[model samples]
Target: MLDWLIIGGGIHGTHAALRLTAQAGVAADRVRLLDPQPSLLARWTQCTGNVQMPFLRSPVVHHIGLSAFELFEFSRTPEGKRFAAFAPPYDRPAYALFQAHCHHLLTQHRLPELHIQSKAVGLHRMGERGWRVETPAGGLDARRVVLALGLSDQPAYPAWTAALASSGAPVRHVFDPNFRAAELGDWQQAVVFGGGISAAQLALALAARQPGTVTLLLPHPLRIHQFDSDPGWLGPKYMRAFEAERSLDRRRRMIREARHRGSVPKDVAQNLRLAAQRRELRLCEAQVLDAQPTDAHRIQLHLSPGDSLETDCLLLATGFDGRRPGGAWLDAAVATYELPIAPCGYPVVSRALRWARGLYVMGPLAELELGPTARNIAGARKAADRLAQVAERRRTGHQVTAA
Candidate 1:
């Protein structure tokens, strides 16, 4: 039996494994991280590359490392010197440099050896407080389990998307595994639906790749924000207010109101503006009511307030639905264990991020406990810090300092 079995080898899982061995004094051989991808952050790499994102929206301090200052200190090193600044005020790190820093952490920590490239199909309690994780290869018993499953892999489809499918139109979500940006070759016109950073990035990519016009259909006008949510959420400034809300439903409402939803960075918005000025992009503030496939390999989009658009291809840059993270796996696990889930479909984890028994969770599922930053890289570190403390206390029977 393993000491710890972390599900989902993305940023959260990888960082949790590192914390368990390094800070919590757990044996390296006793911890295992399970993911479907052949390598760590494979889906993240593919999704970022698909839209050709130049820089990360998050700051340099947010990374898969113990110290927040590690990346900043690394910026002064020879290997990290290749990094370039994004813009003023925010000064986001270049995506390549960020990735290089991650590779360095993996090598420094020897994280690759801890990875198990398999999907966790089922999770159930075993003897006493232990867990039995089921996979296609076999079952692995573990003393504890940490669900680090990030929800980025699950692509969400709008209600109108079903009509498009019924009409036999060629439509694809940007996060679909089989949808390749390169496969959109020789298209004369394309339409993108979304108003977030991914939508902005994909529209720019389409404009650059396709020969003809590209239109971006958004339900609301573009709102530019430095980060996904207010920087205040990163600290106790907004978090204190968030914690004061006693009701979970009220907390959910606070999270929604705090987030600058469907917004993009200033740089991304500028790029889209430049593309529009060049006559290669069209920005439409309209809702897609329905869609049907027309003859000649085109799709007819029925917009709100008596508007319509015809395009050769339609792409949904919309992201995944948070209410249902990994769909079946999470549903089955929640149902089997009778986990305490909020009405909004998120887990109501303990202060130490424990879900039930020996099972713990981080990332989006821990939002109610960790606040708005729960899904970002920074939240992974915070969750790791808390979890490491728990593991250390369990191991040494003494008070442990924060990592």
Candidate 2:
């Protein structure tokens, strides 16, 4: 049996594994990262590439490394100094630089050897022994398990997209793992549906390629925010009050209010403005009421303000669904183990991020306990810190359980 098995090899899972091995003194060989992708952060790379995002929204300090200063210190190195490494305002690392730093960490620690390229299909407790995670290859036993699933798997598609897809129109969600933006063949008209940074970046990319033929469809005027949420959420500033709130419903409301949904950064907004001024992109602020396929291999979107638009390609950067991830497999596990979930269906983890006796959570599952930043890189780091403490206690012969 493995000492720790983390399901999902994205940012959260990779961070958790690194923390357990490097900081918590857990044997590297005893922990495993279970994921469907062939490599760690594959989905992140794919999604970011799909949008052609130049830099991350999060600051340079928020990464899957041991120290907050690691990435900054790396920037001083010859290798890290090559690219246009850091952006202004918050020193957000360029995507390429961030990827290179991640590669360095993974190689230095040999974390890739811990990867198991298989999707976890089911999870069940095995009594005193621990837990058993079901995968297509077989079941793997672990003393502890961490569910580090992210929201990317649950791509949000607007209701109107269904009809357009049924009519054989070219409609794709930018975050879809298989959706390759470069593979999109020659198209005279393209429409991107969303208002967030992803939509803005994708619109800018398409506009550069097709110019004047790309339109960004938004439900509201563009709003600019440097980060998705206030930086206060990262530390005790906002978190102290959030942790004191006992009501889960109110906490959920606070999280929703704190997130700057469907907004972009100032730089991205500026680029969009430049694109519009140059006639490279069109911005339309209206709700999509319905959609249909036109006879000429196009899609016609009916707008709420008595307007209509037609395009050869309709791309959705609408973000991910708000539903609890892990799907039926997780639902089954929840039912079987009677894990405590909030009214919103997310796990009610402890301060240490333990969902149960031996099961821990990260990313979306730890949101209620970790606050609004629970799905970002900062949250992953925080969750890993807490979990590392738990591992240390276990190693020192202290029995720890879900609070």
Candidate 3:
């Protein structure tokens, strides 16, 4: 049995492992990170690479390292200086810099040695001992379990997407596992659906690849926000008030209000404006009412309030569906373990993100407690702090012994 088994080896899981072994004094050998990806952050790499994102919307303090200034400190180094591209106040690291920093951390810690490249399909409590996780390859028994699943796997598709998909035209969700931007061939016209940063990036990418070939279909005019949410949520100001809410339903409502729904960062908005000026990208305010396949191997999107647009390709950058996380695996675990779920289909977890004794949650699953930032990299940092405290306390009490 291992001391800790962390599911989903993306940002949250990877960061938690780092906190446990490096900061919290948990031995690396005693912890195992389970993810289906062959390597850590593979999905993250793919999703970001697919859109050709430039700089991170997040700040320098938000990273995978144990210290808050770790990334900032690295930025001062000669090699690291090449990665620095900030816009003041918020030291928005370039995507390459952020990725390199993550890789440096992984290499320094030998994190790959602690990874188990398998999908956790099932999880069950082992009574007084611990928990047992079932994967296609084998089973893992751990004294403690942390479900650090972030939102990489859950892609949001509207009801009308099914019709478009069955129509067999060139329609694909940006986060679809099988779809790759590089795989696409010559296309005269392209349409990207959604109003968020993903759509902006995709629109720009397609336009740059083939100028005047991309149309950004938006349900509403794009909104601008420097960060995903206000920074007050990161500290006690907003959190104190949020925690004081006492009602889970109200907390959920607060989260919905706090989030910058369907918005892009300032830089993205500026770039998009430039693209529109150059006539390389077309931005339209319209809702997709329906989609039909054309004989020319294309899609015709019917819009609301009356209009239509035809395109050779369609990319849904509509973001992830927050209502469902973990999918079948979560449903199975909830059924078997009798875990409590909120009305939104998210797990009902404790302040420490505990689903049960020795079983915990992080990332979006902890949204009720972590608030709107729960799905972002900053949320991973907050989750790490909470879980690390719990893990440390549990270790000191011998409530969970290392195997």
User: Which stretches in model 3 have alpha-carbon errors above 4 Å?
Assistant: 398-403
Query: On TM-score, who's better, 1 or 3?
Result: 3
Instruction: Please write out the lDDT profile of model 1 over residues 50-99, one tens digit for every residue.
Output: 77777888887888877877776777799888774444555577788778
Q: What is the alpha-carbon lDDT of model 3 when measured against the actual structure? A: 0.86
TM-score of each: 0.93, 0.97, 0.95
Q: For each candidate in turn, give its C-alpha RMSD to the true structure in angstroms.
A: 2.4, 1.3, 2.4
Whose TM-score is greatest here?
2
Which residue pairs collide, candidate 3?
Answer: none
Better of 2 and 3 by lDDT: 2
Question: What would the per-residue lDDT of candidate 2 be over residues 1-403, giving only the tens digit for each residue?
Answer: 9999999999999999999999999999899999999899889888888999888999888989899989988888987888647788889999888988999899999999999999988998999788999999999999999999999998998877877667767789999988988788878889999999999998998888888899999888999999999999988899999999999999999999999999999998999999899999999999998988877488889999899999888899999999999999999999999999999999988888888878999999999999889999999998998999999999998877553
lDDT of 3 by residue, 295-329 (tens): 54798899988999999888999888776577687
